[model samples]
Target: MTIRISRRRLLTTAAATSIGVLAMPYLSRAADRPQITHGVQSGDVGADGGVVWARADRPSHMMVEVATTESFSHAKVLPPIAALPESDFTAKMLLENLPAGQETFYRVRFRDLAHPAISSEPAIGRFRTAPADRRDVSFVWGGDVAGQGWGINPDDGGMVTFATMRRHRPDFLLHSGDTIYADGVIAAEVKLADGKVWKNVTIPEKAKVAETLDEFRAAHKYNFLDDNVRAFNAEVPIFVQWDDHEVTNNWSASKQLPAAYKERSIGLLAARSARAFHEMYPMRESLAEPGRIYRTLHYGPHLDVFMLDERSYRGANGENQQTAYGPESYFLGPDQLAWLKRGLLNSRATWKVIASDMPLSIIVYDDAANRSGSEAFAQGDGPPRGRELEIADILRFIKSAGIVNTVWLTADVHYAAAHYYNPDKAQFQDFEPFWEFVAGPLHAGTFGPNQLDNTFGPEVKFIKAPGQGQQNLPPSAGMQFFGHVRIEGATGQMTVTLRDRADVALWSTTLDPRPGKPG
Candidate 1:
């Protein structure tokens, strides 16, 4: 693979080559070398490029080498990026001008700045670039990891669902939010309903809810402690977004902090958590809005994924029955909603997948005990109201623009289900017919098959969740689920399959593309 190195990178490489002779002796001394704390990862891959991430134990310059072959004999050495204390010793670089429709292997090593002669052992990673043509596309997506006290259980095989998803060998993973349960506390041991004990491999930062920046950063690091997670990260590129749990449970601008949190200001916690989230993952930095999570990921001509940021722009969790489109009804907020509409109208892919962190039409109650206020984009089974208005506007826009073959994929409900939005049977029926498939709880407690709020007429096609008396079931209950998608290059048909922890295909359906020109 030919890489066009920047002038800065070329200079850095030349300097490294010169230092190699003097560094040879120190390299043999393992004790003096810097340490790679976590495994390497790659993400936000496109036709030509992607981002690669790694962390070091101390202040160091992260050196990267890219090659098409695993042997890496003719690897192109990129510029060394610093892994400093400011970013918690983590560093990531965007690798560009790579060949499309090919496997790219990368190796990451940390050269200690303190001891310029010494370097850490390399961590290897790989990712397949998006094809420029209509090649077959496959990806797995799910969310809510290490949540509700269900953390890495050594006895239970340590986040084995990741291992299950890894076996599929998808092109990438669209992590549908709740990447970390920052609001959920992890206990070492807890008695189960079956008269057994569920044990977690815990750390100090995970013992309580994440508040400080270090604590939030540690929450992301805690997931890497699992063998399955680290092994999965090494191979699969992840496109991640955040949700409520990444900050606090159902958090909004007006969130009321619980007694457990000594920090009374929710704003401060959100700020710290946002920084940690960006630093921990391999997400491509947005130039327009640096901290923005809503963006479009075009994966060849087959699929274009629009990942949304519902939490960051939302107003507050309250009675979501507002009739007017105001602050109380703001879900995706004005800017993100406008962006989604524009993106959908401009997308030329056969399938436009809206990768939402939260499921629409699902009645997620912020006050579950009373079932009063809404948490998601639904406000019971009525005409478009509250947050549903924003979604309704998008749907109406899609129909008016004649955009075809749009599908919604989401998690956040802690269950797996397929819903077909039939406009004909709806109270509000301006939108076109579409499908929303939900799958999740990668390694968290199993909850519901939530009640559907038919604002736009969502018909339940298939659902798999805990029974009436089985809410918050343990991961060992075999209900942990995820979703897989594969689009055929020849037919442009999209097949979505929901699977369990054991990699069993619980349910699946294939949708053929509508005969229409791409918008």
Candidate 2:
């Protein structure tokens, strides 16, 4: 756990590191109430305890407290918790008795009566728990950071690759969907018929649903009052999974898009944007009852984290038969696909990961891959739009549930891709090594019109290309690139780095857990 490489001020030779600890927190201004201009967050950590948050300013409930030290006098403090201006004050604090990979320290206080009076000059984080599900575990993923339209600079794309993955501190975080562009807007109303809007794609204005529920809590306070997305919800602890603009465009709860998937008000505005996106992200449900974030996260015996809801038990496509690749159309339907094939046939966990948000390999896009003019594509030779048999029924339930060590980490293609894609022959979906990695939208940058040269025209391609289909990317991980991974289930081995916003590392690769049955 000692990686101190150099080279990186935002370019050239390329190398970076940061994880020394206990020295970089400083916040003065006489003590208290700044309602943070975007800062304070922690999430899903537990070898024992982890999860403290902050968003401050609740019409006067805000108490919340915690400590390890940064001058709470002798901080060990706990037990304040309030913050509820009906949730706009956002706090959370699910702390709980700490001690498991121990590196303890925290900060986030706000009270005038419960007694911390005011604090928040701390933000040094790191956590590691899950140590035995079976023997192998690694976490890190990507998603559409759709915000701040036009060609770039959405908080320096993926928070500069998530502040360079909070300096290589991975244990959890996988959002394979547009985490919220709730109808973004910046490229000036996205016009076309010669109206101009088409340079970088910002399209905002479509979160329509929730005619009541206070306009769905003002669209979840418009991306939790973005301040580099509240400092990436205060540095990691995410598992969120929802695509389709989190509420509009291409929504499918009985349809809406292009011509007519029919029925409107998009299933009560996608159930009020999944209940305001689980009241702002602590996300972890899916057992049923108009809820269930598609559940499954082990991480100890070495890895499991399934996390699916491919748009809530999918089946709604109507606009001229949308088709997510036939077979009675249903993504993770069939009772969570028989509970993900009996939880990967009684798993022991040595790696399973499928926090997918669509794209189990078979991307066509480019206006459905140049139709009318005829190359006659968009998945015809029997697989493309058929979605190669919904990704060969997830690789035939991992070769009839022998459940080796399947791997995948997806995000709605906003740019930043990697693929090995396999279907045996005749482009069953394009052949070989069905591996896919896509990191994105750190703050949302890089889209269309020759996106910084990763050009996807005349045929659409990506495979970390530069020769084989050609992709040469890395003008700072468009959408501000963000993805980092490290795992050592003793021998499962893993590494993926992709960074930006000064903490650079564009692309990386390493994976070895094949598990078997591919012949």
Candidate 3:
């Protein structure tokens, strides 16, 4: 009845083996042990509870214990959750009745049901529950990992930006989509602009574009294999969303896949990618609607985050004609738009944060000819068209409702910048002024300072892009970027800061709740 656990034994046997080094001696000592392969993660942190997640090397009953203290002297043990093959042997448990606005420590272990005594090395993680009342909250938002042929390179610190973000110790991380480059292949060696070859640890599944369900799952799994990513996930609860790279580049429901992915339809690929995404991340699944990823989360009375699913229900990237726009031409479909409107109107929080996977004003041009289209909201240089129409409607509604302090955070651009959109100088002046901050390519190449469409008058504040016309700057050169937001509970002021891989602030700006229209 007494199961003795040893941290030393666990670290020596399990942790030591995963860091790009072989632990043959430890493996020999515990050949049958259920190893916690992907490390531990916590997410969906509510005021009273949160979710703890872990994966086992084999089918086992996963156990989680939560406590306020690191020692876990008075830990609350949750019911055992089965790590089944159906879910790739990953298990998650909801820890309820946890104190709000406080750091909660948790430990996870896997036990063989047949042999109750045998257990895996315990994996530890921590998360902070949402505040029950007004409290200062800070969180980081960014995306586009292992993109532009940049994969995990253990020799070069392996996505070191994740470790840097972890150092900030944000309450949660809003991963603004592109969780994996499912459609992008990672080669063993990539030739950079400086004629230096950047090496990557290439796995079979990541060597080619993902098509099969298992391959898609492997793509998501590849991220966790990195030590830095695993360490970051352990402490920060992530609010995940999906972008085009999760399936393919500039993908939509209507677009036909190239001959390479002829075996799988776009819908099937999206489904497979979504399933893998849900399985790998610790996001809360809705019981009412199981597969829905777009939802809202309230962090105390100060912030309400609306995580959008841009890739799920979208029109074709080439549907850019203003006259061709209708119900079918949607970025955020009618249903999602209605839901967003309702959520924005119903929210009592001071700041309504739209965690968009893509930027609105930036011209994300598609590969189609005529130069007449974009993958994002912008369609033309003038007024709202196609997807931009939907955005304009939402912004107009927000302004008419007098919803202040609305901010948009996105990361698909592969660079970091701040843009303040003002209706005073816009073509369609129905919407009030707002700020949209873009940062990303977390471990990918740096590119943009993308051109802005005047559909909504957006003035660029600051931008940090790759120099010398080089887009694919290796991570080792320190071009990666991410943004952090800190909301002061007392003054209701929000400070947004963009930082590079070196943890140096690229840009920082403080905004009052409603700055009363920019001059």
The candidate that wins on lDDT is 1
TM-score of 3: 0.92
lDDT of 1 by residue, 284-329 (tens): 8887998888889889999999999999889788887788899888
Candidate 2 lDDT, tens digit per residue, 434-463?
A: 455666655554443222111111122243
* Candidate 3 lDDT trough over 10 residues, lowest sum: 19-28
Off by over 4 Å in 3: 1-28, 323-325, 368-372, 515-519
- Which residue pairs show collisions in model 1? none
Where does model 1 exceed 4 Å of error? 1-23, 27-29
TM-score of each: 0.96, 0.31, 0.92
C-alpha lDDT values of all predictions: 0.88, 0.50, 0.83
Candidate 3 local Cα displacement, residue 121, angstroms: 0.6
Of 1 and 2, the candidate ahead on TM-score is 1
- What is the alpha-carbon lDDT for the whole of candidate 1? 0.88
Please give the ranking of all candidate structures by TM-score, highest first, separated by commas.
Answer: 1, 3, 2
Instruction: Count clashing residue pairs in model 3.
Output: 0
